[model samples]
Target: MKILVTGSEGFIGKNLMAELRNRKYDCIYEYCRETDSTLLDDYCKEADFVFHLAGVNRPKDQSEFMDGNYGFTSELLEMLKKHENNCPVMISSSIQAELDNPYGISKKAGEDLLLNYSNETGAKTLIYRFPNVFGKWCKPNYNSAVATFCHNIAHGLPLTVNDPSVVMNLVYIDDVAEELINALNGKENRVEEFCEVPDVHTITLGEIVHLIHSFRNSREERSIPNLNDSFTKKLYSTYLSYLPEDQFSYDLKMNEDYRGSFTEFIKTPDRGQVSINISKPGITKGNHWHHTKNEKFLVVSGKGVIRFRKINTDKVIEYYVSGDKMEVVDIPTGYTHNIENLGDTDMVTVMWANELFDPEKPDTYYLEV
Candidate 1:
């Protein structure tokens, strides 16, 4: 199928185009601000589907709103009519189109034209009156407050929230792209007269700021956000995409000593904590037992022997682990355990604990294995 996508370099257009190509759809005709004007006519003539996403969000003059939003839309539809190409056309309209402002009025005019064309030609048309859309590739500090906030916070810049109580309705770019592709397949989520993307998140300005701030602080805290919440998960993913290229890696606090260092990698409330442990040759670590805190230890390098002994028993169970043959040794409750580096070089072990370590109530008791 030949698909023509206007505003091909735009935030939504870029994402949708990328996904289309990723899905192996190669017959895409891209039209952007830089494309030559005469090419649009040829594109419309051959396109089996049209994604009319070209429009101005922030124009210098109010009149440009109508020209860019309504004028360009009319031109595209007219060209399609000229070719008798009544293929399905999907236009991106804004929820603000219901308002009386110039931008809204222009968007509403574009919507009316598309609906009328659909009625006249009996062509399939999908109109999405979307709210705020946020995701990767969206330009920052221009129109979207979410984009601006994510970029600023990721860069350590301060944010200015005019109204904390202001509510925002957001749709993720992935969802929008998915819904559009679904429409192309004739499975659209249609309301009475318009189409919609099923997944919409309603949040407050204050709440958004709070979540974004938490995402920035997660690096130092070595904690991961509760991704079980879909909104938080998507927002965190968006925030990470905006981080400066050089700031991708952050230093973690390493508890270093003669026996080498231990570093916490990630901590989660439900999934437990992951850490890295390094032991010097001939050094033994972890002669401790827990009442409830359990752990899994995997020797990733060098050689080691993980020894365990049941409380008040003389029986000792030993597992000889080597880097050549990786294995996970589970530390069960009521059994004292220790790992001794038996190799000539340092041994690296990846460790996981069921819960975060707390000094006030450390569930650890030291005893020889």
Candidate 2:
């Protein structure tokens, strides 16, 4: 299907266009701010579907709001009429359109025009009065407070929140794009005369800041966020999008000894902890067993021997592990176990314990295996 997307380079437009293309829809005519204005007429004439996403929310002059939002919308509808195109049209509108402000008025005017056109030609139309949409590719330092805050915080820049107490209704960009695709297929989430993206979330400005800040501190605290929470999962995904390309990785604290070093990779409240361990040749680490805590150790580099022994039995079970032949040895509770590096080089092992190590109640006792 031939699809025409206005404001193709804008945040929402970019996301939607990318999603459409990823779905293998190649007949897309994109008109961004740089495109020649007259080309919109040809695009409107040829498109089987129109995504009227072009509009001004942060223009330098207030009058530009009406010109870009309402005026351009009227022009596109007129072009569709002139070309005798009865294609389905979807307009991106803001919930602020319910207000009496100039921007809202312009957006409402655009919505009215689309509704009237749908009536006039009996063409399918979708009007989404979306709340604050946040996710990857959203412009920073503009209208979206979420975008600005994420960019600033991710870059270590100072931010100014005029009203931290203010609450916001947020929708994720992926959800918005998905809903738009659904609308294109006539499977819209209609509410009254307009449509809505399902599962919009509400959070206070201060609360959002706290959640994002916790994501930043996770590195130092060696803890993972409660990703089971939907809002936090989406917000964390958005936060990572703002990180600089060069700063994708952070250094972890490493504990070193005569044997080698161990670094905690991730720690989760319900899933326990994962650590990377390195042992020098002829070095033995972890000659200990836990009463209740359990672990799985995988040798990823060099050769190693993992030996296990029951608390009372004299029988010793040994597993010779090599990096070329990766294997995981599970350490059961009450079974004393130790890993000894047997190769001439250092051995690297990835360890996953069912519980995080606790100093006060370690539940660990050293014993020869």
Candidate 3:
């Protein structure tokens, strides 16, 4: 099917067009400010479905809001009428349409025009009264507070939230795109008079600020936010997208000396911590037993032998590990354990403990295995 999308470079339009192409839609006519006016006539004449997303949200002159939002919408409708194309047309309207402000009044005008066009041409119209729509590709420091907060917080800039108590209705761009696709398939969320996005999340300004801030802190704390939570997972994904291009990777502090280097990779509140332990050839580490803390060691590279002995028992247990065959050796509580590099090269072992290491209460007793 031939689909026409206006404002194709915009946040929602970009996401929608990408999804449409991914779904194998071959023909997509993109109309924007840069496109020639005559081409719009050609696209309108041949297009089967129209995604009318082009509009002015922030204009230097207040009058431009009506010109860009309502006036442009009228022009598009007239083109459709001239071409005798009565295919479905979906428009992105703001929740502010009910208010008396200039932008809101202009959006409402566009909505009324679409409804009138539908009445006259017997065409189907889908109008979405969106809230603060957010996701990746949204411009920062513009109209969306979520995009601004994500960009600023990810880049260590101060955030500005005037009213922390103000509640915001948020809709993810993916959901909006999916809903539009559903409209193309003749299944849309319709309330009384207007079509709507089916799902939305409501969060206070202060809560959203805190949630995004915690995501930044997770990098240092090594504790990941709850991905099982839908909102947090989506918000974290959005935050990562706003990270500066140059700052994609970070350095992990390595504790090094003579034997090799050991670095803590990640830590979780309930899942414990993961660390990489490197040992030179013939070098041995551990020789300690914990009363309550247990660990599991997996040798990922080089050859190694893991030895363990109970505190009071004379019996010794040994496990030969190597990079060729991966295995995890568990060190139970009250058992002294040690790992020695047997290969000519350095041995690398991944270690996972039950809790974060504490210097004050080591809970470890040194003993030979």
Off by over 4 Å in 1: none
Worst 10 residues of 1 by lDDT: 321-330
Clashing pairs in 3: none
lDDT (10s digit) by residue, model 1, range 1-369: 999999999999999999999999999999999999999999999999998899998999999999999999999999999999999999999999999999999999999999999999999889999999999999999998899999999999989998999999999999999999998889989998899999999999999999999999999999999999999999999999999999999999999999999999999978899999999999999888999999999999999899999999999999999889878889999999999999999999999999998999999999988
lDDT digits (tens) for residues 80-186 of candidate 3: 99999999999999999999999999999999999999999999998989989999999999999999999999999998788999999998889998999998899
| Candidate 3 ranges with C-alpha deviation above 4 Å | 289-296, 309-315, 326-336, 358-367
Per-model TM-score, in order, reads 0.98, 0.97, 0.90
Model 3 C-alpha RMSD vs. true structure (Å) is: 2.4
Q: Point to the candidate with the largest TM-score.
A: 1
Q: For model 3, what is the alpha-carbon lDDT of residue 46? A: 96
Better of 1 and 2 by TM-score: 1
Candidate 2: minimum summed lDDT over ten consecutive residues — where? 212-221
Top-lDDT structure, candidate number: 1
Instruction: Report clashes for each candidate as comma-separated counts.
Output: 0, 0, 0
